[model samples]
Structures are given as structure tokens and as C-alpha cells.
Target: MNELLEVLRHQAAHFGPELARTAFQRGLAVTKKDGTRQPIPITATPVILEAAEVRRRCELAARLSSAALKMAEAVLGGNSQEVLLGGLSPLERAIAERTWRQVSRLATTRVDFFVGAGQQPRALEVNTTIPAMQGYSDIAARVFLEVVARHFRYPERALASLLTLNGSNALALYRALLDGYAAERPGQMPETIALLCRRHDAQISELQYLAERFREFGADADVVHPEDVSGDDAFIAHGKTYQMVYRHLFVRRLEENPSPWIEDFFGTVPGRKAVFLNPPTSQVEEKVTFALLSQALATPELAEGAQLTPEELEAIRVSVPWTRRFRHGPTGGPMGESLEDLVATVAAEPQRFVLKRSWDYGGKAVFIGRSVGTVPYNERAQALYGAPLPWAELCERAVADPTGGGYVVQELVETSPEPHVLCTETGVLPTSLYVDYSAYASVGLARQPAWGGVCRGSMAEIVNIVGGGGVIPLITAEVAHKLLMAWKAL
Candidate 1:
């Protein structure tokens, strides 16, 4: 039997008709939202596992993890906090102190792990502030188990038991990841959890599911919105006036518009709080972050403690081709000799490179001189130079103000030609390689920097880019691993 199908069968058996019906309804709703005729976006494509590929991916992940850890320490040790952490901008040392405090506290209770296909587990972002999707995975596993149990009842493993086992496995993975940190902080295991989200009926089901799971683990849990909780409230509940504030706030709402009341509540609450499963700092979701991170002005701290050697930095410079639209040098000046020099070199290589606003995200407001004629380039150049929009201004003018976020000049990477599968209402579509890698990182480092570069935006650009024929995911796996090892050594 298919592993996934089997899991779904077991899930149905354990959850019974009512829960399964609810899940079916939810799936239907999601399909409607996606404007699809089918209730589920089933994957008809076969996932063939090649042992060699798996080993390669795994090796890459390990190497990347090491490199990332080293860079993390350097960046963390310096002033990368201004970029990575969203709020607060004190001196570097002070920021470092506060960040260390936060990290230490979290290290004790949180378990970190990365999940992806093959050996090269794509670098997903850290689950430190708000670890989400665990419950989702659990539910998915249960659903699969149910599907399997309905067709074949061969063993003692019921859907519920399988789900329990899966959940336990996930938790075990988390614990192993955090074993080092937990050993340092003896008694800070996470005991109670508070599910923070917008007060919406749609979210109730998921929150309720989590609450049940937390209860199963013998931990007290509750679901509440930020507005419902006050400084004096002991628990986060809709209709309650109690003791201490909720320990953690799991943000479920995608659009975060903190009203005055909500802000005041969060500010007044004393205990440590995790913002959401995916914090706002993950700007890679936003194309603007990529543009900004790629710019000369943007300095990505490769890791916590490791600095890119001159050679590595040079390699990065070489990777990015020059363009004229957002060039920084004089029109007729000689090109630069180093990566830093290319900032000026771009102006000279008008045909080879595209000029973009330093703050623009996605392909918006990007002037591909090669695509446009000389006449158009001259006209746009006049407007751009006449006004000479600052980075902030350029960002505001870009489509939906993609430039307002940040910018970078990326030398396009060659994409693979292999065909892949995509699901549609009609049937499965055979597509070519077009997926872009949006890598995430969770590093164990000492501190957060006071003033440095960090990218903030949505991952929509990456998805769009991938949809638009851009393939090949780029990750700093070597950098990540180095940072991890360095921290471990320390």
C-alpha cells in the first residue's frame, strides 16, 4: 500500500466520521479558494527516491549547516541583529546582550530541526520564535493513516496510535536538535503553551486541535487573540480576567496589523512570548528582501561568527553580473576591479546588466536595458537621473512599492531543463525546472547585533520567480554549518 494513502486511511479510522468530515470540508474550502474544481490538489507525480541523490542532498545539508553556523556566530557577534531581528536598535553590545537572553531562554525550551526532501534538506527557516506546522503535519499523518486503515486492517496500529507515534517522533527530533542547548539550561523545558492568533472562527478548529494535543502532553494550553489578553490576565482566553499574561503568542494571521489595543497588550505582558510560527523577519517571502539583500548596500552576515573570507566574498561578487539601470558609477568611468568595484562597473556594462532600484522587490520597476531599446533606456535614464530617487523613494514608486523594502542586483543563474510535474484542475501538467530556492536558517549563536542588515518582505516574489521559469535554489549551506560548528566549539 502507498505510505501516504495508508496514513490517510488510519487517520480516518481514528478520527471517525465527524472529524474526517470537517477535514473534508476544510479541504473543499481550500480548493474553492484556489479556484479549483477538485476538492484536493492531489499529487499524481511519483516521488522516486534515488539513494545517490539522497546521500548527496544529506551531505550538502550537513556542510551548509556547518558553514551557516560559523557565519551566524560572526554576524550574531557583530551587529547582524538590526537585519535579522525586526524590533529594537540599541548599541551592538546591548542588542547582543538582549538577544543572548532571548536565545538562552528559547534554547532551553525549543527544539530546532529542518525538514525537506532527499539528503539535501533545504534550509528552512528557524522555528525558534513560533514553531508552527507541527500540528498540521500531525493532522496530515493521521489523515493518511485513516486512508490506509480503511482499505487494510492488518495490524494493531490504529490511526490515532500512528498519529501519536508520528507526533512523538517529531517531538523526539525537536528534542535531539536542542539537546545541546537543553543541557546548558537544566529546568527550562516548555511546560505551558498559549495559542495566539486573531479572533476568527476559521482559526478555531486548528487552535482547538493544538489545544487537544497540548493537553495530551500534560501541558496547559489556551487559544486567544492579542486583544483579549491584558497585562494582568493569567491566561489567554476570550472572556477572562486573570493572573499572568500568556507565555507565548502563536500568530496565525498572515496580515499582521497590530491595533493600538493589541500593541498595548503585548507591550504590557511580562513573560517571554514567541510571536508566531513564521515571524515577520522572514522577508525572503517578499521579493523586496531578495533585491535588497543582493545590493551593494546590503551586507548579509553569512553566519554568526564567521566572515566570508576575501576569496568567498569575491566569488559572491563574481556571481552577480553588472547592470546599468541602478548603476552607481560615472557613465564613462572605468569598471571596478573587485565586487565592491562592480557597483560602479554596472553603469559601464549597460547592455550586459539591468538597472534596478536598490529597494525594488520582484521584477517590478526593473529596467532590463537589453529587453528595452536604447530610446526607452535614454528616456527612463533621464527621469531617474533628473529626480535621482533615493532608495526609499525608489521603493515607494515601484509596483506596490517593492522598492521601499530593499534591493539587490542578481546575476541570473542558469536554470536546469529537466521536466517536472504540476497539478491542475484538468490534470497533471508536465513542467520544466522552474522552482527557486527560498532558504531559511536557524542558527545557535551568542548574540544579536544592534545595527546591521536584515531582509523583510514576503516570499511571493520567490514563488512568482519560480513560476516564471527561474529554477535552481541557492543556499549558503556551507556558511550555516560553519556557524553551527563554531558555536558548538565555543
Candidate 2:
């Protein structure tokens, strides 16, 4: 591993320019809402991991997704409280159940994880909604591999032997969509599909990338915004009725406009109108969902509700960190300490935990106690708490309304920082950044694909791409082994 990093760094000049050119040519960029285009942060450094590690994380994501799936099934089968506790609004609940009844499967999702001390893997959050970056992973790992392989003078055929992009997230999602379409409209294949999102969404580039790939994979797919969506008995975008729809937009975004067509299109899901690739999943996508998964392992009431098997429970016990819905009143700590009020305990000893809104994205709602004094943390804390409270006040404020289900407290899992070279269009620079691994999983797909992990690194504890951290492509250990041997031979 050390040898690979050193060799790549030593040979930067030979491959850096091609890497910059490849990024632009392939459209590997994300947009701001204002439509300001920026290169998706690329780090030439690709984190290599054992294939088993990748498989475990994906399987764990699938298990929890299955837990969410069972929870969704329970809702479809008539129990709605679990999703409500997972933070879906009543209207959101109605939408989720309706969609779940129709779609009946989870197509794609991403699980975020951190490898803490002793190399213990801790599951942090599940990104069931818009679990992105499959395309970006392909572009990064494949591009970096191709460019560096060229620098190493490897022949064209040898390009693929170095690293695997896990059959590409786009293809995995494409296959899942096909299976969903078949399940919904058995014996029929959709001629056209729509990747729906709000116009100028931050992930526009990636959506476009996926749309094109879907088309390449044989589904005539288009990236469409809600405003353009129209239909009565079917989904009509750009005057064509798409038999399948992959909604990349959130319900809140849909509610913002609430046009008649948007209502008909989504509000009437899993129907004759079209097959939803990703059903309304905010129910299973919440941090509380994982908290419940964590809580279920210990609390029999939740355990019965979750219906996880012994195998699933064991995995959660080992991989899912200690977490609970953060609220006032009696609670137990990670070290078995008892407390009358979790809020007060957290306020008193803020260093041991992290707080996050049950439903949030882009790391905007994450607050780490150990980072209290730092400007980045302090500024974010001030914005969230209406003025940075003393640590105790911050803790008190972190607790959410139990009735509505708002916050989750997690035992902090400190991920180690390692050396990485940040790759950008301008140039590449060596730096040490805190990075975490994310594995993508598809629930309800008939055949599972080889899904490699995606990585993000940042200067702060909260590592998110939208927070301005960069993406590090992951190379499987097998590929790294081969690449290393080939490098030394050269």
C-alpha cells in the first residue's frame, strides 16, 4: 500500500494533465443551484480495500435496507408508526406507503461508514434516497487507472486488470430499474425512462451522466425536472409518456411546487401510470431508521418491531455504532453509564457523541462535540443553535421533540486521517485529510452486482462531498495487489 502511494506520487507529472483533461471531457462535474459549474473534487489517490470489506459493507447496507424494506412492508401491510418514528411526515407517510405498495422493492442506496480505532467498521448513516456517486466512481477510478496505466506504459487491454469500478453503479441501478419495471408490468420492458429531479439540482451532472448511461444500456432515458412533467393516466415529459420514472428529487422539493401534474405523477405512484425505480423512501432513509436498528438490538420492543434475524442482529451489533433517538429522559450510555436524562448527560459530556437531524443531507445538520472550539465547527454550531451555546447548552438544544422525531445521538467513531493527493483541474497537491468509506447496495434486485465502495475526505470530522470535501476512488485489494506487482516488475 505504501509502495503504491509512493509510486503514484512519484509519477504525478506524467498523469496529472491527462487526468485534468479526462475530467472535463467526460463531464465529471456537479452544479450549484445557481448553475455555477465546478469540477467534482477528484483526488488522484484511490483507497484500496479488500473485496470482502466492500462486500460486507454493501451487504450490511442491504440488510439495513432490508430492515427498512421490512419496515416499509410492515407499513404497506398496515403498521405506519415505524416510518413515522423514522421521521416521515404524515403526508410523507401516505406517499411512502402508496409508493411502497406499488414499487415493492428498494432499487439502490448508499451506506456511509467509518473505520475507527482497531480497524473496527462503524455504520454511520444510510443514504437510501438519492444514494449517488456511482457514475462519479467509474469516472474517477477508471480515469485515474487509465491515465496512470498509460503513464506506466501498460497496454490497452491491461487497463481493466488494475482496478474494478464494481460493474459501475449506473449499471447496477439500471439492472434494478429493469427488474422493478418487470415486477410492476410483468413481461413488459419500458421503452423510455425519466430520471426526475428539480431543475438545477446540485447533482445535475451525475443525473445527466446516469441518464446517458441508461440510454447506452438500452433504455431511452432523460433527466427531467418536475415543471416539465405532465400526465393524466401516465407520466409525460417533453410530450412523451415514460413507462418508468426514477425520482431523484425529494418530496419537499415536490411539495414546493405541488403542481397538478407533479401531484398526479408522484402522488399516484406504483400505479398504471409508471413504475417508480426508487419509491418514496424517506421513511427508510432517516438516521432514526439506523438508530432504531441500533436500538432494536438491545430494546425488545423495537427488536420485535424491526423483525431482524439473528444474523442481521449480530452484524448490527458489530458494525452499527451505539445510537438512539436523542431526547430528554432516562437513557444508557455507550460505556453502560446510566443517566436520568440523555440530553443532560450529553450536555455534560459532549465529547463522546455526535448529533444529527433525523432527516438531513450534505452534513449540514451534523454537530460534533469534540470540535466545539474550532472556527468551522463553531460557525456551523452557531448557525444551528442560534448562537453557539456553551457545550451544555448546545447539548440541551441538540435534543429533539420526541413526539415529532427529530435528532439522533451516536457514539463518536473517530476515523483516522491518512495521506492523499487532492486532484483538481488546476493541479494536484499532497495533503492529509480525514476520509470515510461509503458502500452502495441495491435491495430487491434479483442479482447483486459487484458494488465497490466510494470514499470522501475532508479537513473536518464531518466528511461530505457537498461540504467541499473530495471523492477518492476505491480500488479493491486484488487490483492493488496486481498493480503493485506490475509496478515493481516495471
Highest lDDT model number: 2
Off-target runs (Cα >4 Å) in candidate 1 are 1-40, 44-101, 104-132, 137-142, 145-191, 201-209, 233-235, 239-405, 410-490
lDDT of 1: 0.33
For 18-114, candidate 2 gives per-residue lDDT tens digits of: 7866864675676887998777666777787777877877887777667766654554455645644446655566676566655556678888888
- Per-candidate RMSD, Å: 12.3, 2.5
lDDT of each: 0.33, 0.74
Residue-wise C-alpha lDDT for candidate 1, range 1-490, written one tens digit per residue: 1343233333333333433343334331121223342222212222222324333333332233323333333434566444333322222223233333233222111111122233223222222333333333334334433433333442334445543432332243233323422344344444545656655433244455656666565555666666665534344355543222222332223224444444433332123332211122222222222232223223454321254345433422433233222334333221433545444444335444444443222334455434343443434544654544433333233323222332334342333233333333333344443232222223332421111011111122222221132111111223223222432343
- The candidate maximizing TM-score is 2
